[model samples]
Target: MEPESYYFLEHRQDLWTFIRRNPEWYRYLTRDTERINEIDQLAKQYFGKTIPQRLEKAQHNIQLVRMLIDMAGAFRD
Candidate 1:
């Protein structure tokens, strides 16, 4: 699934809340080690960033979640 597919738009708030509550889950959801590392770096960056900055990042991250979910669905096929 492409990141711009709108799946993330529909579930953005829920996914944002989930990530904020369970940041570690990002590692589990993203099967790619590279992505995991990237997220880890991003997580570290989140510490000093403002809420708006984090929300902007969240918009991008939620698309990754949508991609992971779509990939999981593909596995069931």
Candidate 2:
């Protein structure tokens, strides 16, 4: 099956909490080295965007991934 993205309803609240608390750390943990390399190869796709905007997108992706992991753990409980 395809992996879930933003699939855990229960983790939404906690995800928001962590994001609000430490956005930078949240993003650092969620970074996709491979995709980052791809984006670096073509930053023109996201040119004119501020660092904050880029960080927000990365953070959102990270939070969604984390939420899915948390949901899987909960499911196993």
lDDT of 1: 0.58
Each model's TM-score, in the order given?
A: 0.34, 0.36
Question: Across residues 1-77, which tens digit of lDDT does each residue of candidate 2 receive?
Answer: 11232333124554444445644533543563233334332333335255777788899999999999999999999
Candidate 1 wrong stretches, greater than 4 Å: 1-48
- Runs with alpha carbons beyond 4 Å of true place in candidate 2: 1-48
Per-residue alpha-carbon lDDT of candidate 1 for residues 1-75, written as tens digits (9 for 90 to 100): 234322442355544554567767555545443353444445555553557777988998999999999999999
lDDT of each: 0.58, 0.50
Candidate No. with top TM-score: 2
- What's the distance in Å from true for residue 72, model 1? 0.8
Clashing residue pairs for model 1: none
Name the lDDT value of residue 67 in candidate 1: 97
